[model samples]
Target: MEFHWCKRAQRQQGVAIVEFTLALPLLLLTLLAFGELGRMLYQYNSLLQGSRDAARFVASRAWNATLGKVEVSPDLECMTKYVAVYGAPSTPPCSLTGMPANTTVQVTKLAGTNDHVQVTVSYVFSPLIASGLPAFVGNSVALNFPLVATTVMRAL
Candidate 1:
């Protein structure tokens, strides 16, 4: 009779909610972590694209000595507006608000060499829900992540 009962228990061995319950948090955490990482990467890519576009735009324009070698100075005020296509000041939770203060666009012209433009974008990121694994010192606080993008094009 005991052997019969043991055999019956073996038939039901795979039905338990405890296993799933234990795994639920981990699964959710993985999802959130992936989501946050994806968001950060997307933003970073956008900044890079913006930098590239800006560089291309500046390099293609005919250098005007009256204005400057690179016409980027007057366009400085419109940098964010210009970078809109690349997701600057657009993405949620990481909008233009995310841009670091005192950001600058540096342009360098090399005689007979490719002109270089550097755009430095910085943002603060915080851990997403159920994903506190990336916290600094395990503290739930916002941390700044600098995103730098550079592009070079043949001088016109």
Candidate 2:
């Protein structure tokens, strides 16, 4: 009886290996897809928070000095750089991770409301899309996606 059971197990020895071989590629691709999606979300969320902070900071400050009227304040640039780097004396988190990190900060006032400020933070994503994912994400957008976040709030 023991010898019969051993022979039966030997007959099925290759089954698990075969199954794993067939499933490995799909599993790896799925993990890679999830990794890409998570990275995009993280970049977007961080940029959004940075823009909001900068916009709020600028809103509380005085206006810039133009020839006769007031232009945008120079402090906006300082604040923007500060927020982009994730605050003073600290480098950008993405930079430390070897991620593509070109952050551009834009500040504007609402077209109708002078007391409202709009802040736009844009980042260039890295690691261009894999050819295999183009069908799902659109062929034209397969390259690195541009991540942008904008925030609007009433000024003080």
Highest-TM-score candidate: 2
lDDT of 2 by residue, 51-87 (tens): 7787766666524333322234545545544655464
lDDT of 1 by residue, 1-156 (tens): 999999999978876776888899999878877987898788778767766766665555535566555444444424433452443333222223344453544555544533434344444444455333356566664444555666666535
Q: In model 1, state the lDDT of residue 111.
A: 44
C-alpha displacement of 19 in model 1, angstroms?
0.7
The most accurate candidate by lDDT is 2
TM-score, prediction 1: 0.57
Span of ten consecutive residues with least summed lDDT in model 2: 89-98
How displaced is residue 30 in candidate 2, in Å? 0.9
User: Listing every candidate in turn, what is its Cα RMSD in Å to the true structure after a full C-alpha superposition?
Assistant: 6.8, 6.7
User: What TM-score does candidate 2 reach?
Assistant: 0.67
Q: Could you tell me the lDDT of residue 146 within candidate 2?
A: 72
- After TM-score superposition, the amount by which residue 37's alpha carbon in candidate 1 deviates from its true location, in angstroms, is 1.8
Worst window of 10 by summed lDDT in candidate 1: 87-96
Question: Which residue pairs collide in model 2, if any?
Answer: none
| Whole-model lDDT per candidate | 0.55, 0.66
